[model samples]
Target chain A: DTAVSQTPKYLVTQMGNDKSIKCEQNLGHDTMYWYKQDSKKFLKIMFSYNNKELIINETVPNRFSPKSPDKAHLNLHINSLELGDSAVYFCASSQEERKAFFGQGTRLTVV
Target chain B: GESVGLHLPTLSVQEGDNSIINCAYSNSASDYFIWYKQESGKGPQFIIDIRSNMDKRQGQRVTVLLNKTVKHLSLQIAATQPGDSAVYFCAEVTGGGNKLTFGTGTQLKVEL
Candidate 1:
């Protein structure tokens, strides 16, 4: 079984449109994270949630919000999406400071 | 101001040969380091990891070396195969938690 999975592997939307990506982990991990990989293949941390509590929030725009309903799920919602939002969004989960397991990633294309 | 970066953007190696990818980080406080391999249309896969206390760690055919004094890290692969061709990234974690700061990936091409 896939340790971590994200829905809508590919997303294509117009600018100003709102979209959401859903992530779930079956590894029983307490910490989950959202990372953005640009065309240059530079992965940057966007948000981190530990046991349903927000812990790390990067300099991302206000349009981006992450919600973790429980320790098993973390979802990302983007509002007023701009063209710059185009990139591959990855979902990762880990136990404490251990190595993180990543999902297949969702490619978001905002035109 | 803390960032992890790669020295070479790309590396080409022959099959059955060894390959080395280098990374540099500006964060001296980082205690944990990991290397990830990403293939096309897939997320990064955990390859190997090392802590600040250890200078080297080996996994399968991959090895990770850390130099705390210079804040540098390297991943060495032995007998690289064509299937090993992918983009590799080095990530660091500081102050614990799950926040992993990844470096710019290096494309590894294993020629058959």
Candidate 2:
């Protein structure tokens, strides 16, 4: 069974478009996070949630919004996509403050 | 600003040989460290972790060594195989925070 899973392994969209990537975790973890990996393989934190509450929100643009309807799910919605927003997005979860388990990743390309 | 960095960007190793990847961090108050492996087109996978109280930890064929004095960390893999080829990252958590800051990463290529 997959501990953390995100939908749309690949997403290709044009600029000025709006899209959403969904994530779910079955590990019953209290914390979930969204990370972006650039072309150079640099992984940076974008957003974090703990028990359906927002915790960490980095310097990401206001175009990106993350929603957590429940503890098991966190969805990222990007309004007015930009070419620079093209990157691999990963969803992860961890219990307490320990190691995190990541999903395969969603490669979003804003063409 | 706190950051983790790797000495080498890429390391090539022959099969049957051991491999070592090194990382350095700037955060002295960081209490936990972890190593993750990421293959092509995949997310980072947890390899091993070490708490500040421990200097060394082992799992399967991998061993993690942490030196608090120099704020350095290393991962050693025994009998490196072709399947072991991937980008390895070192991450740290400071002051018991849930945020994990990752290093630049090292690409390990195991040659046959």
DockQ (Cα-based) for each candidate: 0.74, 0.67
Interface RMSD in Å per candidate, to 1 decimal?
Answer: 1.4, 1.2
Q: Where's the lowest-lDDT run of ten residues in candidate 2 chain B?
A: B93-102
Q: Which pairs clash inside model 1?
A: none
| True lDDT of residue B73, candidate 1 | 98
> lDDT of all the models against the reference?
0.93, 0.93
Q: Where does candidate 1 chain A have its weakest 10-residue lDDT segment? A: A93-102
Q: How well does each candidate reproduce the native contacts, as fnat?
A: 0.71, 0.48
TM-score of chain A of 1: 0.98
Distance from true position, residue B17, model 1, in Å? 0.3
lDDT of 2 by residue, B1-112 (tens): 8999999999999999999999999888787899999998888998999998899999999999999889899999999999999999999986467788899899999989
Q: List the residue pairs that clash in candidate 2.
A: none
